[model samples]
Target: MHGEPAVLSVTRYHPENPIKMFLLQPLYAPLLFPNTTSDARDHCANERTFLSWLRLAIYMAIVAVAILVNFHLKNQPTPLERRLSHPMGIIFWVLSLACLVTGLAIYMRTVTKYAKRRALVQTGMKTQAVFLVVSAAIIAACALFLAAEVQASRQGHAGAFDVTFVL
Candidate 1:
């Protein structure tokens, strides 16, 4: 092998099952797009971030629905409990809805911005930081709301935590 000039034959591999290829195309799609420039990598990263935001938004929505369902399943929810869960559940739902909208809007905006090549990588970083901060604040607010509900339930007093102030 060493004396034969070590010839290597390379061939593109295609899956025999079209269905499997179609299903898995997304996972390998990134490889098809070469990142020859920094902007391309940045754009790719931005897309991944956008998808992450979408996933987070979906998770938040699921949690909100779960809260509502759990409360309804209870034999009885006090007036205060109902008041708290109803409003908080709605708030979570709204936040998640906003997240979805914001994700799409930001993704489009970023794609456009990068396509124009008017901004630098620093701008992208700053935008990501801002998004993260906003997400954290919303999550913190949700946590406080849930914590209050938990405390109220444990104390046997539905009004132990006033969610209005947090709102």
Candidate 2:
């Protein structure tokens, strides 16, 4: 305490106790900043929220890929059907990218908010609800488009193709 800063005063390591030093060095280590401003709980919740959004983004990407794959699985979709599928897949992928960016932005903003606030404040659920509704609407519209195309394709081929069982 006399001539040195408090953070480095406690950083001494005993040569015989490497394990303790290894474990405790972090407590006394001096970095650019003293330490993170937010508490452990706030940081953890923010991370969980961020990770959940990341998982959703990844799921959206998978669904986007699957949508295109499903179109290819069909024997022969009409030109219009192929073109529609392409846009649907691309839109889904774009949504996924948006989700990733939004999630990261929210996480960073929340962290900064937590650091500056003296008390906890709840975020608006309305925004979350709107996002969910819009995402679901896009997915539902895509599904309906694909479904209609399949129905039309089936109806077009129903009478032309015949299958018989010999067994």
Candidate 3:
């Protein structure tokens, strides 16, 4: 296909059903809002940081939910599942929940303080960007691990349990 690299022909393939057509529209919705105007909000440095932190908190919540769903979807029997699902899973959820809550609480506190320190300006571009990239990778790992467990259970494989040391 000798053509411009950036140009994609959307008309080449048509949706085979109404559901596919319905889903395709939303996939391109963001492209349709190129000039959409954003609503006014706190633009202070601290406020922005706080908002980004809250976004991180939401991501952590999503990660926790993914883990929870994986736990509940385990195909093992109740006794076996209860035995396998203990300190490790509990610790994971607890740590994630703590991080999410702490991030959100600090974000709220910073927003309140920002209202008073409206003139203060501290743009942390480098630190914020680095933390965002690292934390997003961590969340992606959690998502991948959970998805792996789900697929394993679907294929009738025992989860990564300690079966070798049952002496």
Candidate 4:
């Protein structure tokens, strides 16, 4: 036991709160045992990167919500408008979920690498950029779908109700 690090046995002290202990153990481990300044900075940077990804996920989710709300509130005046709205809504929702899952996956990967004390600079950038590119592509697809929906809606409205100026 001379060279071995001491481990805190949470169950020994809080026998009734096993779930709390399990959930919080990892969170408090760093505070309990301080690491070198470089390690601390690395962890902080990792957290910042995770937050950035989380922010992007949130933004995408917001866009999905906006699309959902728009479809819900707006009355579809024509059959074409009604038909296009449903698929566009689905695409936006799926894109949002994909972004969220990808963001979480990247965060988990970075955390695992950091825990393993692996060099994260090169690997992290490449993986993150790939995810970003995929997310961007999905977003672009959603945008195109949205544009098509808008165009169809406008055409439907024009054909159904637009007044023509004839001399």
Best by lDDT: 2
Q: Which stretches of candidate 4 lie over 4 Å from their true place?
A: 1-34, 71-81, 123-167
Error of 4 at 139 (Å): 5.5
Question: What's the TM-score of every candidate structure?
Answer: 0.52, 0.57, 0.32, 0.53
Model 4: residue 98 alpha-carbon error in angstroms: 2.6
Residues forming the 10-long window of minimal summed lDDT in candidate 3:
30-39
Best by TM-score: 2
lDDT of each: 0.57, 0.60, 0.44, 0.54
Candidate 3: regions farther than 4 A off? 1-43, 71-89, 104-167
lDDT of 2: 0.60
Better structure of 2 and 3 per TM-score: 2
Error of 2 at 163 (Å): 17
lDDT per residue for candidate 4 within 29-111, as digits (tens), equals 42232364486677677667767767766766666665555443344433543555556557656656666665556555554
Model 1 bad stretches (over 4 Å): 1-36, 71-79, 121-167
* 109-147 per-residue lDDT for model 1 (tens digits): 654444344434334554566467557756775676566
Q: What is candidate 1's local distance difference test score?
A: 0.57
| Cα lDDT for residue 53, candidate 1 | 74
**Higher lDDT: candidate 2 or 3?**
2
- Candidate 3 residue lDDT tens string, 11-52: 432344423432454354311211122212443444466566
Give the better candidate number (1 or 3) by lDDT: 1
